[model samples]
Target: MNALLQQLQDKQLIWLANQTEAPYEHCQSTGFPALDQLLGGGWPQHNVVELQSHGACAELQLISKALNHSGSELLQVWINPPAHLCAEYLLQQKRPLHQLIQLNTHRAADALWAAELCLKSGCCIDVLLWQNSLQLTQLKRLQLAAAQGQSQLYLFRPLQTGQQLLPWTLSLQLMPASTGLQIRILKRKGGWQQQDLLLPWAELYPQFIKPELQQRHSSYPPLSRVS
Candidate 1:
């Protein structure tokens, strides 16, 4: 009887595996080997990703390489960025500034409206929105918009604000490490990641500031003071 139950479980597991979609089919390589491996190849396209971090800039550094590789035809849109995007830094990394569209809004509602428009228009392949708090219903709306336009949507929020469940294809918690960034995969489609992955900062941001200086300046002030 025990042997019979074990056989049934084995067949069930195989069936589940076959039913699941392979990660590489839908993911875009994040440009980091360790991260790519952890994410089952890369970030999922046509989905909403939630990035939580103490410092808003940390998320930017994590995705800079992917953004740079977006090509000329598709524009990278930034809605209410936390800090001024340093043109010199982008130049250093060889990311084309002309390919970026930045929009500033005084209210979160406006930012959400603009992000939805950008995602639904099919004009941009990547949209980054820095909004600290969003309702679950609002996130669902954005997720649907991303799916409709086949665009990758990244939403940045403070670590403290991500305690609630959200409708995200991939959700990650980024913390600063001595050598690089420590990524904790909070939620994903297939399975939960038990271990945190360390991605060297130099690989993505060769000109990253020293660990000591980065720590000294990395603090989340009030969102009102961000601009």
Candidate 2:
């Protein structure tokens, strides 16, 4: 009996010890339920997640949620959104700049570099990267940084059509929804491939979307197939 007790103690197989395992720190949401469900309960603490899209395809809710820091935690957010976007309108949509550490630059490359640095620093909950286009090299670098720091990085690409699996835990392809955005997990951690995940802005706020059907102009050009 004494030997058995010593073996059990060596393994530390007590209930109290089991309870002491570190809980997975999740990236907070913008209070949106739909989006949260798509990415397996939001961004996780120890992996890299990429968001790829273009042509009005963005993840504003996700961004807002990531910046919604708590526990007196200061999370940094680096953005290089398209120039056409109205920062004022964006501010109106998402208020309170107290928890944000944003860097608004015209060059997407610069913004991505900044995001990689922040992720490696491990000072922020997770790094969010967004831009019109993303290069393969840049993404690989970011992944390495995230791994080195043991931090989660969220990469968003505004315009990408083809699909190529990289060394990422999750790859979410976002589409613009009438209310908010649809988050489709193209590649999920643990080899889970799910279909279209839709989340509306109305889920987070009291906004109504009225889809206006307009006649397609002759020169409107052929619609590029949305993947």
Candidate 3:
């Protein structure tokens, strides 16, 4: 009888090992090779990623490539975006405008509510939310909801908020640079990266800057030359 019980336990362990998926297998590429290396392949699915930056533009640039590469069937929802998203810009980047949805609200509470609902609904595979501040408790709630919906949740907050310990699958800080954006990984599931990566802003969106701005900033060194 003891031998029979041991055999059953061994079989169960083997079955569990076969059913579990490797962590890297669940990641989706961020479209930037350097960024992918830092993230251990790509962004983890069914997790909440927090991006803090001075302006929403930097965060948008970071994820623009991923959005453009995403499938047409996957909906990308934006909640309380900082500024008006130009349709022409998205189209030029090869992002399907039809798959993009935006929900605007002035109140923070309303914005949070809408974002949580969208994450829990499972109607969208990717959800982007921009808000002023959120308590750790509130963030945890959203994190659980995101896990349940199996959605990729991105929360954008102002850099002024500083750093705080929170339950996030990944967290990053975006600093504007003359060449592009400097990304610092604050927290990640498996490990932490101390070094910062400079991703050329122009690589993600060629037409983002106006002709006048480009001419004025042309003297600045390019991203590759930085550091």
Candidate 4:
């Protein structure tokens, strides 16, 4: 039993509850200062980060900073995007169009297969995969693939299975807010369950913020004067 447990730990299949700090050696900034702080510096590299939402909730903008941070050197693969990705939006955000590649697979299995391949290729910086649901076993495979290639996978999923605890390096729920995304950190490498953090897009990305909330900040009284 002892030997088996050690093997599981060595394979990263078992994580002790008290273990804190990211298991990975490196992490990249998520772009938002508040988010970076919440994530303990940035998104952990060589791991799967699961992002869940009810529907389209400006999730792409959430990772826009990371994309820009990676630069145009390596490939950034998108597997099974719901709709045509906007080249203009990516360009405006400073993400290199030259490095971005979108792959459309005939089936979901094919998409996951492609994602694993991209992650293990060692030439891709990041892989963004959109799938309706994922089995825990499948996540483990992706996680291993990412670690092998020293890459990151930003996975998008529906909100239905958000409550279930999984083995992902990080899990978050992106709720749409008037100003931007109300992000809830479901899980992380450090095992810290953070509170819901509001990333005001109006302040960061003015173009994506709702019109009503654009002036909400200005209308507030000065901070020191509040009694």
**Positional deviation of 137 in candidate 3, in angstroms?**
2.1
> Please, what is the whole-model Cα lDDT of each candidate in the order they appear?
0.79, 0.60, 0.77, 0.83
Candidate 2, residue 193: lDDT: 55
Task: Using TM-score, rank the candidates from best to worst.
Answer: 4, 1, 3, 2
TM-score winner between 1 and 4, please give it: 4
- Tens digits of per-residue lDDT for model 1 on 1-227? 98987898888743455544574347777877888888888888788888988774357767776777665687789998878888897787686788888999999999999999889888788999999888888888898898898787888888864365775678898988877788998888765556898876666565655544654653666688666
Best by lDDT: 4
Q: Write the per-residue lDDT of candidate 4 for residues 1-227, one digit (tens) a residue.
A: 99999999999999677676565578788777898888888888778998998767778777777877773688999998889989887778777787899999988999999999999999998999999878888899999999999888999988865367577788888888775689888877665667789987665566756668557456576899778
Candidate 3 per-residue C-alpha lDDT over 118-140 given as tens digits, one digit per residue, 9 for 90 to 100: 78887778899988788888888
Clashing pairs in 4: none
Q: What's the C-alpha lDDT at position 47 in model 4?
A: 86
Model 1, TM vs. native: 0.77
Scored against the true structure, residue 113 in model 3 reaches a CA lDDT of 84
Error of 1 at 190 (Å): 1.8
